[model samples]
Target chain A: MGLIGGSYAKALRRLGVKKIIGVDTDGKVLRQAQEQAVIDEALCGAGPGLQAADVVICSVYPASTLDFVKSAVPFLKSDVLITDATGIKGSLPEDVQRLLTGRMEFIAGHPMAGRQGSGLGMSQAEIFDGANYIVVPAAFNSSGAIEWLSSFAGAIGCGQVVQVDAVEHDRIIAYTSNLPHALAVALINSASYNENTKYFIAGSFRDGTRVADINPYLWSDLFLANRENVLQELAAFSQQLERWREALTVADAQALQEMMREAAVKRKDLY
Target chain B: MGLIGGSYAKALRRLGVKKIIGVDTDGKVLRQAQEQAVIDEALCGAGPGLQAADVVICSVYPASTLDFVKSAVPFLKSDVLITDATGIKGSLPEDVQRLLTGRMEFIAGHPMAGRQGSGLGMSQAEIFDGANYIVVPAAFNSSGAIEWLSSFAGAIGCGQVVQVDAVEHDRIIAYTSNLPHALAVALINSASYNENTKYFIAGSFRDGTRVADINPYLWSDLFLANRENVLQELAAFSQQLERWREALTVADAQALQEMMREAAVKRKDLY
Candidate 1:
């Protein structure tokens, strides 16, 4: 059992995946992971780090994931189960499957938990506690592959296992993650560089704009890759903003109150 | 000395005001204040609370702060300085000046620091720590009143103190607090909410919508009371959201990235 991956390697080791092989492009990160005992064995190579492994999980960058999967296809043991921790699924599943010459099964998976501060040092095994694990398995994928993927997530203490079609997975994430990222980025940009303006910021501004500190390079690729669904979600958000603007324009106190009251009640009910 | 008059009470106590009396409409709150030693004596009655008060400071709700000031004006001792802790300064300052037909001087003040959860339970002598205390003294106000108000805020541990006009204070708050609150409420209301849809919500959704749980009644009054400036700020925010929509519409990756990048920088740099 080789846990050659990113931050999730730390979690896997904590879950009793003893023979973990840590892999990263960054030498500093590999050493840090070793110091933190996030991985038992460390490996960094031009090829995928999973050699003679029963199961191989890739937790690489979102853009390079499918490419990594393709490069690693020849090195994996015959009939080895491969999975990912990428946010999007549709394209990766198709591309990796085609690249593998019909030998390996790629199960697209996402752990619905991450801290803003990325990399292994910040990774914690407890991040999976009460978090959702979404699996987007292709149609031709084996039930064995799906079961193993679920078990992998469960072993790391994911609270719930969710399965959705590849297309649906991408669409939901376009709305859930991509669109919110865009909004945060836009809102933060509008403020620009103003020294005098920040003094008045309270907890709401801090909390609401927390995600704006994300790596834009990663987000830009994800947004463009999942373009259609993200565009739809963005339009929906605009429509909502317009409704709010209309209420504010007419000084419709009652409408504003109703909107806020409904949201307050519903939001208060959420964990 | 009256602690309820304004934030000056804390400072006055630190300056050895001796025999500080706390007055609030809530009897339980008054008793709690007394029990906690926030005041030397806690008076539930307005008449009894005003007795021998060398300085009267009003820290009431923004809308009715004027009425509170006027009602207490008659009982105030000669040469007693009047100040306030209301966020809005324009209306209150005028009312305080008009209603107080005595030798007492009126100075408007606002302490710009508070927790999300307000009221006496979260209140403390340390609430003013590292907070800005704005002293909006009236045009006819004597230097003595202004100095006393500054001393009051300083005594309460407010690190930064400044003076501004009533209109300026209201406009600034309308931009800072009211605009942000309205934007947050609108965003949360616009999100897709259903039993199944919520299953996909991650940290982004929870953090983005946390402020939606705020009290609508309190905020409704706040927005409506500061209708002019809040409406102006709402227009500015609407324009910003429109820019975001336009960027999304064209799938302008560079534009979106720039926006997000700026926002990220501003959020990160915010002190």
Candidate 2:
């Protein structure tokens, strides 16, 4: 059980989801989850237990998620619902729905809740509190399945349940999540790379660069999965930064102040 | 009095600096400072009473700071020490020290503490409790003046007292303060400017763009005053971001992950 899986298990338990069975490839992780009571039942792989499961949630790396779904399809019960907590949804949701069309339903969900730390030790049920939960439904998804997932998200303490198409979800996430993470990494790398430079940092720099402390393996997969949208956002951000750079070069005080004022006014509505 | 001036007055009072006389162009602000006990006395302009003060601290906008120093010089005592709490050095420190050398010392200081809100209503003495206080000494500053300013910074509840040359101070602050603000503003402007987009914001986006909600008039002056250094930082940040963008474009997952890992390791030392 990793951080996302363990956190989902804990949240499911809190919502009175009995008989929570966790399946992971690692035996040590299964044993740890069992000892911590994060799961009532732990399985090394998909087995007969999957036939009895009404709904299966896959929380894995972005690239591995589709493979996990494909492997579990053979063992899943007929008419079962399959969902995932993956950051980027390229065409996987539609592909999975096509693979299991008549037998089951597949919907993609992304919980905007996580810590910089990883593994089961860092997971907690309350991490989902006041966080957004986004559900992406393809054409094959039924209305009843979407309703059930939305209500389940509410039960698990998600402050908001947002429904959007997969393409729109990935596009918005490229700006809101991926862009910020990329900027933080770039900002951190842009520093002087000397120990003494750290002493000059203040709260703004610390807050601006917090996401630079990231899990590289997971983020690289997310970035590659949604390369086009992320690239578009990167281009937009660089263009805006260049505008400010030009303003500063010419000492265009009016242009600089106007940009700051507009940003200040727009940022107020975010909170 | 405004936010920074009122906060400094309150902090000085906490350190038992008796008879704090505040001078402001606005009479209403002066009356508010007097009513809130932020200052023992408040005056609308530089008066004859300034000749009796042992030290004078000017907390004003960057462009107006030099003019304020020039006006107060004629009424100051022979050995009075003058310091300013301005965001940018802007050659004003050297000019002021040159004008008053062998008569009074002008040490430029910048307290790295402020709130998003303005005016005396939002001022609090505890704002400086754990914040940094930078003392930028010019060529003409005496060792005794630097020593006194450092002790005074500690007395006023500053956690760290950093001493740096005026040029070095501006260069570092361009990275630590100005660049972050510029990035924040650019990020906010780069958004689609749609109200619906705000719903997708999470902790990272909020933290990365918090400084976007800044006072335009004040920040414009700071940016123009230190244009060269800020442009240099902007150029460096753009170059780093371009590197990441190129990595993402080629689907070079290994290169992207390596950069992220290096940033994560470097960010750990900031805390």
* Top candidate, metric lDDT: 2
Candidate 1 per-residue C-alpha lDDT over A1-271 given as tens digits, one digit per residue, 9 for 90 to 100: 1222544776776777757776666777778777877776666643545765667777766788777666677777668777887787757887777777545777888888777645555567777877888989888789999988988888888878889988888888876677666666655555332565555555566666778887666666667778778767766776766766677667677877787888777676665
Q: When only chain A is evaluated, what TM-score does every model earn? A: 0.90, 0.96
Candidate 2 to truth, TM: 0.94
Q: Candidate 1 on B20-71: residue-level lDDT in tens?
A: 7787778777777677666787666467458588876666666666777667
DockQ of every predicted complex: 0.45, 0.73
Best by TM-score: 2
Q: Which 10 consecutive positions of candidate 1 chain B have the poorest summed lDDT? A: B1-10
Which regions of candidate 1 fall more than 4 Å away from where they truly are? Answer: A1-6, A35-37, A46-49, A101-103, A117-129, A141-144, A191-193, B1-22, B26-45, B54-57, B115-133, B137-163
Clashing pairs for model 2 are B1-B29
lDDT of 2 at A51: 80
Instruction: Name model 2 segments beyond 4 Å from true.
Output: A101-103
lDDT of each: 0.69, 0.85
lDDT of 2 by residue, B1-271 (tens): 6888888889888888878998899998888888878888877887787987899888888887768877887888989998888878868888877767347888888788777757788888888887888999888888999999888888888887889888888898898888888888888899544676666767788888888988899999999989999988988898888888889889999999999999999889877
